[model samples]
Target chain A: MTEEGKQAVAKARAILENYKGKKLRIMEVCGTHTHAIFKAGLRQLMPENVELISGPGCPVCVTPADFIDEAVWLATEKNAVITTFGDLVRVPGSEMSLAGARSEGADIVPVYTPIDAVEYAKTHPDREVVFLSVGFETTTPSACLAVQRAEKAGLKNFSILTANKTMDEAYRALKDSVDAYIYPGHVCAIVGTRLTEELTGEGISGVVAGFTPSELVTAAATLVELCSKSDEPFFRNCYPRVVTRDGSTAAKKLVEKYMEPADAVWRGLGIIPKSGMVLRDEYAAFDARKKFSVPSFKAKNPPGCRCGEILQGKCKPTDCPLFGKTCTPEHPVGACMVSQEGTCAAYYQYGGVV
Target chain B: MCVGLPAKVVSIKDGMALVDASGAKREVSAELLDELDPGDYVMVHAGIAIAKITDDDASEAASVMGEL
Candidate 1:
């Protein structure tokens, strides 16, 4: 670390240690942030009055169980191969996870990127390929690009099952739950700081944060210092190196060309109006939900699993009766336990820290 | 799956860039970014280069704190 970096860390810690404000509840709105916070031991550095909470930032964690049921149905009944990021394979559906279905002869393939799924479909012309498109803005463009590539290649067997969500609405829904937020850096890298800056107009305060120790601490310091000055809201792009004020216009235009906002259900937060993205009508042929006619199952979190409450910042992972015992990562009962970025997974990985 | 990998672009062809994150190398879609060169550093997520990383986080953090 440079001298300036060391000074920044020392100064941030000093400010935090000298904090004399009221009890503050700050939520990190990305699952990756939750993991990074735990990995960096940021919580240990906080004063007793400040608390760090997890928000609905993990895309797979927020994805409703019904979406997984649709994927399982495509794999089992429709005889379509399910291609997805590995996290979604373990997330339980209404009946079973993709992994569970795979055990019972469902063909499930985990790909690192949506483009890889396109390649898989290109190679297997006889088989129907459905990529489980579950992410926020960060991964949504890749899904769009995949659909465009499939269209250009004339690959009739390729489609995507979208559970893609946007962060703007989720932040609005949870505005009253915390004093400020540690925004997901990558999401801002796509959508830019305009939305977050506009959020301050509505009295929502936050800082766009990166995934490094110095970046995380600096964001916390900024929040503490700003919030202490007054009750007014503020926004800062702490991770300016990656997130620009405009973000990526090309990516934004691509998403606009392929997908549109739709009312989507979150596992915990329910359906926030226009919180999710779906392929436009013209691209229905590339949409697995329409192409396969897979029915949406009425779904709910498993009994006694407090993942919903945990996701909303109403409670912590340890507050759930099944968190460490029944909902172990090896055999997760809820989506929160399955994804590495999930809050429950991070808490468990960090020895159930509060 | 939402994790972003900061990688150095080694080569580009037909809207695809071969990136090296740490020691691992792979071809990721570069169609999103308008201008990218072989030596540019970018944040790659889900096999797509999302944004160009300007500097290391240490320096970024220093500048952020300097403003704070």
Candidate 2:
């Protein structure tokens, strides 16, 4: 094993050995950690007393299907070019995905950064370029910057279909709902430890952890220990090198400058008030809602898809009847099985089964 | 969703810094900090350097961690 892996394993073993035979339930909020746990075989090594669960950390999983349909609709427009992160293209919509639409003569392009979307519009000034902006705090600043750049360049053809949400709201929504939270290291790096203070006040214990087998085990063990001690919410940094008391101020500034808090709809969680960010009026020229006149479409969850329950921390991937049988990664019925950082995809990729 | 990390500023040019994180290198904005430079660890989120991390504090915490 690598040195980091060995250290993580040692720490995890120490945590497990110390908490063996104790009753505890811990939930890791990051889908990446969920994948790491199974990938490292930590679940097999963990004591029976400690139960680890998955939370709503996957951005693609939480995105409602209506948003996917809207993107697909935009892709089908005569002169409209749809660009998005690779993960969104294959996520199954109620009727079809963008990939499926592309097969039927829709113009769809996958780009890594949001800036690439702006560049596409700049290159093809006559074409309507829509950047499908989706992510949490980590990617929000970039999407905001893209909007600013579009406005600066006077690229009226450049706009974004934003589905950006903040991490604190999701954490707060899950506080009373879960036993303990294994907070996402990446998300925490943006929001920082201050958000944990509020989570603790609501009686949730949180530990920001990295996405490695050993790091996941350490987080699980810390959670068990914290749960064994008190009902008060605790904020412990297992990923202290990456996360701090205060998060990224510059990213926060960019986000604040270009976007404002707005209500967003999650596939399972319904409409969360002030959980999403929309482009400010100053950058309204880059807003997709204004650029395209998309008709309102009803959001629909796939039949027999328990992604909603899985997202709410009420059920595991195995609890879903279609987990491995009908809803494998190859033929996913929901977004959870589509994205790499999604809970279902994590479970399917690793050795998790229903 | 958001995937941010901590990086150290290695050099600064035109309101941007050549930042390194555990062997990963990328250009980041140095507009937020007052006097950041080489060997300084700063919290990096979404490709931007947000704050200066004190070496003393990090070392003290690392030492405590090593003891653990």
Candidate 3:
């Protein structure tokens, strides 16, 4: 927390006290908020009328099965090198995981950045390197820069499989699920405050939040203020330090130059329109999908996973029968158990749920 | 949420900064930010120095937070 004090807590207590009989169904649509809320025990602190639900914010959790299957296919069938974030490597598809494929001699490397993949491609000229780019607006700029770097270096073997998503579409689809929203702060830092402003302007109570525990508490108190005081939806910024109304112009321009918005398939939410980024035709040679067609196969989630319901804010992780018992983090049965940012994994690790 | 860490800038070369993130040094792009120095603290995310955090900025934000 940036500053530790008793005033914010007292103010939040006052707000919750005022809303004793009224219910505020607020959904936190950011993975960090989910973790922070649980870590701070804010759910336990809030009154019962203050219902805080987790949304489909974790990119690792909401990555559709087919995307993983395609990454696995590229490695197993085409013998191409796979590069991705650590969390994605363990996510289970319908058939196999990238780790499973790696155990079978597939070269899938976990990297801290997309630049590492570019470096790998530069060194291994003979091998086809496909960077599995999975993230939101905050990471999409780096992915674009990597593609630009690879092109500048004249790396013919490098391509990217992008699964980047935008948060606006999800908010649009989930408007009715909650009375207000605690938006993702880091995400808003990149895409700008316009996202939350847009949603709020449309009659959805919302606030952008920072990752700190005290910030979450303060944001909850602010949300109660906005919802109870105004019939009209309003926007509040709890993370004024990092996020601005316009966001990073340079990053946004690069994204516009390299990628275009397309429909994306979220794990629980299914296909949401214009929520994903795809490589532009100008960057056609750097697109792994255009270069090598992944073998098409029917995708399915694990039986009794209930990850879909969890992603949609319809149910909690404990609501699922396999949450802690059959789907522990060590051996995850669903995508939620595979990542620390995931709702189920966070609840299990924190040893409590809302 | 995006994974980020505050790192100290080591050196600049070709519009990239070699930064030390908790003892482990890694090269990240400095294209997204404005000014930088060898010892300045930067918020790095996905191999890019996204923001430069200063004492005034921190305290200003903290004061606002305390007000909440």
Candidate 4:
């Protein structure tokens, strides 16, 4: 093994050995960390008493299916071109996905950056270009900046269909039953560590960890140790190299300047108060909802898909009847299977579910 | 939570900086800082530079990990 790998294993073993025979529950809130834990074979190494549960870390899994239908509608428009990240293309809507619409005659293009969508709008001035803005705080800043750029460049045809959600509200909404939170490392880099102070007084342990196996195991071990000691909240920098107490001030400022806090509907979690963000009134012209005149549509999830339950940490992916038997990645029944960062996708990739 | 990385500013363009993070090159807005340059490491979140990371903090973190 590489030196880093060896050290990571040794550290995990030390943590396990220290917390042996202690009853503790640590929840890893990030889907990437969930994938890393399984991939690193950490579960086999840890004692049975140390339990690690999953949380709503997958942004794609939490995205409501109704939004998917909205994208499909835009794609099928006569002179509308829909652009989105690659992972969102295959997520199933109530009836079909953007991929399905593309199969039938829709102009849905996958672009790397939001700027690419802006360029596409410039090239096809006659066509209305809509970028599907999806993600948490990490990606929202750029998506907001894209809208600001469009406004500056005077691109009249460019607009974004935003379904952006924030993390602070999501964490606040989770029930008090959760013992401790294994925070997402990437999200911490944007919002900074100060935002987590709210959880400190609530007696919840918050440890920001990276996606690597070593980092996750270290975080899990730390959570177990912290929980065993007391109910007091502790913020440890497991991913100190990347995360900081202040977080990304520049990104936060840009997000604040371009976007405003608005209620956004999460697929499983429902409409969290001040959880979603929308373009400010100054940039209202770039807002897709205002620019288009689509009929009112209420999209629902596929019948018997328990993705909502799975997202809330109430059940595992394998607990669903459709898991592996009927709903594979090729034919995903819900957004969990469609997103690369979804927990179901992680479980499927890392041999958790056949 | 948010996901971001600390990257070095390699160049500047249109009030944005071309940053290098472990060989991955991305453009980040430098609207937050005034005295940034090629050798400075800044935390990047969602294509925006959010904070300036100092050499002391980086070394301290590396040392902690090394001890583990």
DockQ, all models? 0.78, 0.25, 0.43, 0.30
Q: Lowest summed lDDT over 10 consecutive residues: which window, candidate 4 chain A?
A: A1-10
lDDT tens readout by residue for model 1, A256-304: 9999999999887788999999999999999998998887689866899
* Tens digits of lDDT, candidate 3, A77-187: 899999898889888887878999999999999988998899999999999999999888888888998998999999999999989998888898998888888888778
Off by over 4 Å in 1: A352-354
**lDDT for position A146 in model 2:** 75
Per-residue lDDT value at A319 in model 1: 90
Residue A167 accuracy (lDDT) in model 2: 70
lDDT of every model, 2 decimals = 0.90, 0.74, 0.82, 0.74
Q: What is the TM-score of each candidate against the true structure?
A: 0.97, 0.87, 0.92, 0.88
**lDDT of model 4, residue A131:** 93
What ranking of all candidate models by lDDT puts the best one first?
1, 3, 2, 4
Worst 10 residues of 2 chain B by lDDT: B55-64
**Candidate 1, residue A270: lDDT:** 81
C-alpha RMSD values across all candidates: 1.3, 3.6, 2.4, 3.2
- TM-score: which is higher, 2 or 3? 3
Model 3 CA lDDT for position A224: 82
Q: Where does candidate 3 chain B have its weakest 10-residue lDDT segment? A: B55-64
Question: Model 1: DockQ against the native?
Answer: 0.78
| Candidate 1: residue A107 Cα off by (Å) | 1.4
Model 3 lDDT per residue over B1-68, tens place: 78667788999988899999779999899887666788988778889877665533334334544554
Q: Give the share of true interchain contacts found in each model.
A: 0.74, 0.17, 0.35, 0.21
| Higher-TM-score candidate of 2 and 4 | 4
lDDT of 1 at A13: 93
- List runs of model 2 lying over 4 Å from the truth: A1-11, A352-354, B2-12, B16-68
